[model samples]
Target: MIDNTSLAVVAPEILLLVMACVIALVDLGVKSRLRNLTYGLTLASLAAVAFLTGSEAATGETAYGFGRMVVSDSMGNWLKCFSTIAMMVCLVYGRPYAGDRDMLRGGELFTLAMLSLLGIFVMIGGHNFLVIYLGLELLTLCSYALVALRRDHTQATEAAMKYFVLGAMASGFLLYGLSMIYGATGSLDIATVFKVIAGGQVKHTVLVFGLVFIVAGLAFKLGAAPFHMWIPDVYQGAPTAVTIMLGTAPELAAFAIAIRLLVEGMLPLAIDWQQMLVVLAVSSLFVGNLAAIAQTNLKRMLAYSTIGQMGFVMLGLLSGVVNGDPVFARNAYSSAMFYIVTYVLTTLASFGVILLLAREGFESEEIADLAGLNQRSPLYAGVMAVTLFSLAGIPPLVGFYAKLAVLQALVVSGSPFYIGLAVFAVVMSLVAAFYYIRVVKVMYFDAPITATTVAAPAEVRVVLTINGALILLLGILPGGLMTLCAQAIVRMLSS
Candidate 1:
């Protein structure tokens, strides 16, 4: 029986859904001058959802709804809260950019973004394979549409098609893998599958085959190397606003689903999946760093940087279990969760600046376009510099602490192979630093490429400042958020 108690577990999602429809309908009557109303309402809805999620997380209770297909717990709630804030900040940063490009003409961007967040909520809460896949499709479908929203732009259209085609293929890979697991285990519920696998009766060959495809699907979604063909194209071709959305928030959902399928549902198969993740991590670090150094376009460079970041995230995940011991699970997974959170924070600020520098008829995507950014807008330039330094894992920045946590987790495993993985990750970080620093150099040392004053809405400026400050603050005082991540993971595992 679906009771009020069960329904309350998903109250935020329900509220968000209703608000989304309301916003879509309200947009119909809003004129361009009054379009801010629609944007304001969207922001308001996100804030409310965040509040609800935060409240739920504060209770420190884990609840299962819909026959355990959906869960409300610390990890999921915190992720939802952060994802909402990320989207809110994204919309704030995206408004001027969208308005200048006429992408806001029909209020579709706002609606689509909210719908995507709903997908994120679903993905985070899902505890069943079908439920998770439904969420993934919702997110991907919304993303494909948003990428192509600039229907008149050939590049956007092309990028959208590529994303759709590749995304569909990945989905098929994931579905086949899930079906194989079901056939082997006789269930689709994640907990049931885990129990079945733990029973030691599943066919080894079939399970391994399914694991491979599942990892491929996950790699594609996370934009890890060898499966990351879509990221650069999509980031460069899509509107910068949409690119920011693509880069930041969906990542939280990806992390959640990874935890659900690999950690929560397939821990018995950890040795197998761990081997796969190691290869993905190594290739991602190697390719992502090497490829980024050659990119002149800022967005494309960031795309490659994202690939490297995902590699690090994977490193933490893969190192969780060694020799059938799960002693390091909490540390490793929590580090990964922290890494994703910090990465999303830094990414939002990095892309936020790119979006801010974009004027009408100008995309500001080229690294050269940021020449003399220090002279043109010192404040924004500083913000961008902080973010870049953070991404490079420079000390006294949140990104550095994020990296340290993961490396520490890797080292804690006491496995020489994982220790070597840690070493390689550090080397890749060094290699990746060159491209990141190059952006700062261009901003500070080169002459201005454009003379127009770089002005943005006050809200964008305030949010960017806060975003940049948080990156620095969290880096300097990493204990609080680190503890939060650790606690969330502990709760998740315990429940």
Candidate 2:
């Protein structure tokens, strides 16, 4: 009953596992100061895996592998490819910063990052609830270790503890909700769960209650308001390198799972879940923008920005099913996918600049610390300014197009509630823009706090430049990536 075809679908994941283990062993003989060896190996592994994913997607075959426990489709493959690229960029941006903070001493950061990426792969490909949960736990466990990597720092330790406790509770909520669904539907496979729900014999009350918990769990994962108490503390307290790792790539993984659980596995329950998302979205937009304006810590401010961004993503999701009309589902979900991808790209560049500014015995974490960034380095200041503009949804930037796509998705639904939601989101963007622009003002208008010359590794410079350029380039020519996202969603939905 072994299927070689199933193995083919997961070839990249298998290769990643082998590479991670090899790196772990190879790192043992490597010296601490020469951590570049570990970094090179990690990047090589990601490159190889990304190549494999691209090849898989090119085959244009949707593979139901491992007894349907996992799936390989264009959507999953593309996400995997981008996730690998994101992690590679993260490591590139994080390297010198990690070196300054003594974080690369033992290769733990590299190893943990690789493992977390492996977990993301699993989450993206999983087709069974148990498989998805296992992947979620894997990613969270690695994240906990990474957050606490700077064990000597009291703040890091405290952040790690808080993350652990809250993350555990969220896991419990998701598990209990999944168990209830299982008890009702008598299936562990996501496809089967959908079929069971579609059959219309399940208890309505039980399923709805289960959905309540599932949404709560997802809100926690997405860092949406009311369940987002942990993001600010964790983002502020963790090492900037860890914060960059936590912010960018994992979001793509999170988006994948959200698609898997809500759209794919629970489509029959759209009315219920869409209503829940509306509530989460409105609250997140209201709270995230309002809170971000008050933050002096740059990381914490970005954390709140993250919450508001997630709200936009939720708006797209909620608009997918208006009054039981799923005619616009693909458009809505694809728009959300596009939004998350662009947000992650902008986030990486924003944090890359922060990492570049940080030096030994100094953490450039406060917004005021960005004073005269334009004077120190106009290139990076321009990069940071573009990044902020993108986040604020300014025109001629990818973020603006992303927001436009999602708003269009909402308007296409032709529902008053969704239209109102779009208006509210626009207002929130305006509120959020004030803080983002304030950072740019400090960078250009205020005086330099120190005379430190801003310099990054050559690799980091190249990557950051490409990252910033892509945001603007995509804004100008949004067709290619937008088409790719739409095609992936359509293909996945059809298969």
Candidate 3:
């Protein structure tokens, strides 16, 4: 029977759903070119949701709802809070860009984005395999529609088709794996599967087979190497606003599910899965860095850069269960969490700058488009430069600390293998620095492509400044956020 506690557990999600529907209907009456009413209502809803989730996370309570199909715990609540805030920022930065391109003729973009965010909330709270799968499908379906929202553009339509076909296949892989696990354990609940696997009653070969498919699906979602074919095309082809929306908050959702499935549900098979992660991480580093070097398009380069960054996340994840010991589990997972959060923060600033530079009928996609950006608009150039430097893992930046935290986790494992992997990651970071620095150099040293100064809405400028400042501020003093992540992970594990 549903109770008050159950309703409270999903208050934010319920609020988001209702607001999305309301905004859709209200947007039908919105006659402004910018859909100001729809935009304001969406932001207000997101702010309220963020507040609710933040309050829940701060309480550090764990509550199970829907007969244990979903959970509201510190980790999930914090992730939801962060994801909501990221969505708000994405809409703010994307509004002008979307308006200029005539993509806001209807309220579909606002409605679709909220629905996708709601899907992310479900994925984070899901405690059962089927619930997680349902959430995944909801998020992917919305994404496909958003990518194709520019109905008149051939490139956008093509990107949507590619995303649909590839996403469908990945979803199938995940579903099949979940089915095998369910068949083996006679349960769809994550907690039940964990206890069953720990009991060692199931066939090891069968479990490992299912795990292979599960990891493959997850790698595809994370845009890791070998399964990241859809990212670059979609990023380049879709509207820049849509690309940022797709790239930012959805990533936190992917990380949440990774923790839910791999760490919480299937950790008994750590020995088996950790090895698979090693291969994926190393290959992603190699492929992401090398391929990025050949790209002239900024979005595609960042897409490849994303693959390389996910490798770091994988490294942190694999280091959690060294020699079958889970002593470092909290630290490792927290480091991974920190890495992803900071990555998303830095990505917002980078993409915000890109969105600002792009004018009507001009894509501003090529690296050459940023030539002498420093001379034209020092503020955005500095923001973009800082973003690129952080991505390269340079000293005293959030990216450097993120990489350092992961490497530190590996080294603390007392495993020569993990330590060596850390060294390899460092080398790859060095390789990645080349492309990132090249972009910086273009902005600072190259001749200006246009003499007109870059302009932005006052709100965009304020948010962009804060976003860039956070990168630097967090890099300098990352302890508070790092501690929060560690505490959240510990609470989740203990509860």
Give the per-residue lDDT of model 3 (tens digit) for 1-495: 789888988899999999999999999999999999999999999999999999999999999988899999999999999999999999999999888888999999999999999999999999999999988999999999999998899999999999999999999998998888898989999999999999999999999999999999999999998888999999988889999988888899899999999899999999999999999999999999999999999999999999999999999999999888899999999999999999999999989999999887887989999999999999999999999999999978999999999999999999999999999999999999999999999999999988978989999999999999999999999999999999999998887
Q: Candidate 2: misplaced stretches above 4 Å?
A: 32-34
Off by over 4 Å in 3: none
Best-first order by lDDT = 3, 1, 2
Clash pairs, candidate 2, are none
- Please say which candidate is ahead in TM-score: 2 or 3: 3
Model 3 clashing residue pairs (backbone): none
Q: What tens-digit string does per-residue lDDT give for candidate 1 at 298-381? A: 999999999999999999899889899999999999999999999999999999999999988989999999999999999999
Error of 1 at 87 (Å): 0.5
Q: TM-score each candidate.
A: 0.99, 0.99, 0.99
**Position 485, candidate 2: lDDT:** 88
Q: How accurate is candidate 2 locally (lDDT)?
A: 0.91
